[model samples]
Target: QQQVKQSPQSLIVQKGGISIINCAYENTAFDYFPWYQQFPGKGPALLIAIRPDVSEKKEGRFTISFNKSAKQFSLHIMDSQPGDSATYFCASTASNTGKLIFGQGTTLQVKP
Candidate 1:
């Protein structure tokens, strides 16, 4: 109940295509859902996020679709690009805990 597991450890998507990645968590107490985008040798930055009160959130080319009942969430990169090629991580934390638990990570390669 304290972990988030992601799949496809790595992915290859064509430029201008849609890139999708999935993740699952066991803890129902997790209230804040945040997806992070990280470039090589850089710290993860908040790309987009949603709270249990909302079902989905979108920011520019990035979107997060969340399901509270299923304990699952996913990241969708619309019109992916070689420049968008990087690592994506889904993270969560309980309301009061400032610490976030992240998935293993998904390395997305958007080929030009």
Candidate 2:
């Protein structure tokens, strides 16, 4: 129930196009939702996050759409660029533990 599953192991987005990825979880106890962006051989960086209380959250060119009842969430990258061509991970955790359960990882390729 602590697992957060993400899909589309890979994606191709043209420059200036929107890149989308989906994730789902079975645990209702999870309250924190975070998305991480990673480049080759680099650590994941927190791009954006949202709490269960909010239906959506956005930061800069990144946005997260969440559905509490459906136990699902997604990340949308607007105006994608070559720099945005990296792996994206959707994660979640309960209130107590600081540990995050991550998705399988999505490789996004944005052509210039």
Candidate 3:
């Protein structure tokens, strides 16, 4: 199984601050990297993603920083809010495999 290691099982951030979550993968075959956010009693949804060729990708207040050579990636949430409190997961997918190898997940709490 492809293993993706995520750090800081949990995190606490102040509202309007930045929230960061990191992940590392062991498989080089993994091509696509995406971040997912899950709210209480809700299914996870795609937050943002980055391709191996791109070092970084940003969408609104969310950003994904990827390091292809290091097999690592991270999510950055700017101006984090209480609504952003949720379990975030980082995942990798290989081309045409339709399978995602996800990290353990990081639970974030944004304090106002």
Candidate 4:
């Protein structure tokens, strides 16, 4: 079974708008939750991350809201710009093992 599930395979937003993507997991053993952003012809880069202990974390326009009780997490982009358009992925890893399971992906397009 897939440990994680993501919604809205694609999204579109206007410049200065907000872009949101969500993910859910069933594994309570998951301790590390991270989001990655990838651009065309580039490797996925770590965007933001939050542990189960933390409720939320934000970096500039990027924010990750985590719900440990619900076993879900979501990413929000504020004032999304065209340059921010990229494929975002959410992943979880267990502490006992270094195995990371990733969500399918969400392709975001920020229109200028």
- For model 4, the superposed segments whose C-alpha errors exceed 4 Å read none
Off by over 4 Å in 2: none
RMSD (Å) per prediction: 0.9, 0.8, 1.0, 1.0
Using lDDT as the measure, the top candidate is 2
Q: Looking at candidate 4, what is the lDDT of residue 24? A: 98
lDDT of 2 at 46: 87
| Model 1 lDDT, full chain set | 0.91
Write down the lDDT of every candidate, Cα atoms only: 0.91, 0.95, 0.92, 0.92
How big is the positional error of residue 34 in model 1, measured in Å on the Cα after superposition? 0.6
Runs with alpha carbons beyond 4 Å of true place in candidate 1: none
Q: Which lDDT tens digits does candidate 2 get at residues 20-93? A: 99999999999999999999999999899999888989898899999999999999999998999999999999
**Which pairs, if any, clash in model 3?**
none
Expressed as tens digits, the lDDT of each residue in 18-55 for candidate 3 is: 99899999989898998999999999998888889889
Instruction: Please give, for residues 1-112, the per-residue lDDT of candidate 4 as tens digits.
Output: 4379998899999999999999999988889999999999999999899998889899998889998888999999999999998999999998888678999999999999
Name the lDDT value of residue 4 in candidate 4: 91
The alpha-carbon lDDT assigned to residue 70 of candidate 2 equals 96
lDDT for 85 in candidate 3 is: 96
Single out the weakest 10-residue window by summed lDDT for candidate 3.
93-102
Enumerate residue pairs that collide in model 2: none
lDDT of 3: 0.92
